[model samples]
Target: MNKRLFLSVFFLCGLILSSNAQEALFGGQNITSPEVHEDGSVTFRLFAPEADVVQVTGDFLPSVKIETQMGPMDGPGKADLTKDDKGVWSFKSEPLPSELYGYSFIIDGFKTTDPNNPFLIRDVASVTNIFIVGNGQADLYRTQDVPHGTVTRRWYDSPGLGMDRRITIYTPPGYETSKDDYPVLYLLHGAGGDEEAWISLGRTAQILDNLIAEKKVKPMIVVMPNGNVIQDAAPGEGNKGYYKPQFMVPKTMDGTYEGAFEDIIKFVESNYQVKANKENRAIAGLSMGGYHSLHISRYYPNTFDYVGLFSAAIMAREDATGKVYSDFDQTLKTQMDNGYKLYWIAIGKTDFLYDANKEYRSKLDSMGMEYNYVESEGGHIWRNWRVYLTQFTPMLFQ
Candidate 1:
């Protein structure tokens, strides 16, 4: 054989041997990091023999009060894991309630996701591994054998903001196939969230799919628009490209987003086969988005017949300007007088905005306005927001 051909053969054999050795070493054992048992107990494992310490933190554990710039609030709990002789660290949680939960592993002081769990979700900039304990409400968050909805990300012109923006829309299972006109629900996200927040973190599509399948909720279109006025879309989804997301962005709570709310409505109404009437329209949101929902619903007066505010930021901002924020009491009074099918308000008992919501309720009481109010146990968290969405949707267009 030629010298060049012999050398090439030798190199190829060496490469194959190296690849096989690496695979054998790394893929020798299958690690199931999170194994959900039959009784709702969760066992988490990590194979990190070199780490000095390993811990787990998640919403499934009890909450602890943590001090933040916004004040003290309840945050996720943490627990230590035991390392076995095989260098695998593991911890089993007590039987938890039916809910979708997220967690991260702290290996030697560095926080990271479970490599074995491919299911993950991004909340603002922090990405965490997620799992669900089924059989109840969490079942709605899961994709079952029931008919599912279509989630589409589309772009529309926002002449008020002078740019094209992105939005996430969920149409019911038979929307495309049927010639029927459905009612519309304008679902908005909280601060630090974007158009993708509801579909991913809030589990909007899954909830609608399960509920509509069960005949609990009416078949309607859900429109999720970016609440932040500064960005045209979610982080890494715009012209600027791949920037880290933060909890607070510019123009989030300002009147600009509320003033331009009509743009989103127009896009949805003109493009989709929707019932374009007050009785068939609804608007609801969480946190900052709730603030927008409150303002926008009242600002338009006769637009939406159903309004919901989930853990809303009800405090007045001295910096806010424009017609949307102006004459707040009168606009709200106008909204109340115009009437609605359902004016619902929901908040967690420990939510930081609880006091603000209470004050707003007092004002409404003084004005002789009536609304359905519900208070659950928790803080300003996504778990409560997801619950609120499920409860609010069933009450719309009924």
Candidate 2:
């Protein structure tokens, strides 16, 4: 062989060797790392003793592979995750607050949760996992007398989405007591989630119970709707394209969606003995549901007076624009024509949509639209959305 060809072969061999070495480092050390404290710095470690790759997954890091300590993905955010010599794979977490967050390991594109922590929020149809941080004083969780809310499993047919879906409605203390028509707040779940989400995982009902019993919030009815326009059997698996999700906001839903949202409202109004009108009704949601509230409120301007977007999936750069504002104007127009009130937006300081919500708020400012915006401690997880609803409800229907 010629000299050049021989050198090329050698280079190829070297590359294969390097890749093999990295793969060897990544075996069975699950990608998830545990919280460690050392003076001030936090340390994280993963233990995947029988796997080929492991990388930490969370909202903080959208991408992967920041370093190459173990394998191609061994150092930091690597897919070819690495483990210690004794099947112990771990790393120190960045300085973080005592608030809750979600994380997992992507063995390929699939996600896996931590085995050590028992406290977790299950995802839609019980498919995935999210980590809940103990409220600083871990023992307080055991001793605190937190009043728990009641979650009732209910089903409603959504004419807007063209399907039948289940939802969880959380009624506070006085719901079953009297013939009072309490204000209603319609809560929407995120993409790849279902009606059981907020109740089973988000814990909206429990928070309300604790708050209302303490007189922290006014008594009201919380209506959680399944956001997807189409029905989902579970996460990652569905009817494919035969159905649509409610979160998908088009230029308009004139011919699309089959008015699934309206059906939801109608069903609730007819069935539940609750005040049903712009003044007595509100809509709010997280991620995709945030998008739903904005669009749904716009579409059903006569229906909802108060609108809340919790860590809305819409981006300032992507959603804050003329068309969006124009649609918002139309929604506000209906409310203004009818003397409606309350438009609130909230997101976590560490949330991905933090900056986006600010920009959206700025847009709302430019349009002379009145809205309430808030920033709390968290990221794009249910923990933040839960508190956001808890804080925003007391101020509603006043």
Of candidate 1, the 10-residue stretch with the lowest lDDT total is 22-31
Per-candidate RMSD vs. true structure?
Answer: 2.8, 13.7
TM-score of 2: 0.65
Model 2: per-residue Cα lDDT over 257-371, one tens digit each: 3145777778778877788667888888887778777776766667878888988855323443433345556665666465558888888776656777887787777767788
TM-score of 1: 0.94
Residues 341-376, candidate 1: write the lDDT tens digits.
999999999999999999999999999999999999
Count of backbone clashes for each model?
0, 30
How far in Å is the alpha carbon of 157 misplaced in model 1? 0.3
* Deviating ranges (above 4 Å) for candidate 1: 1-29
Which of the numbered candidates is closest to the native, going by highest lDDT? 1
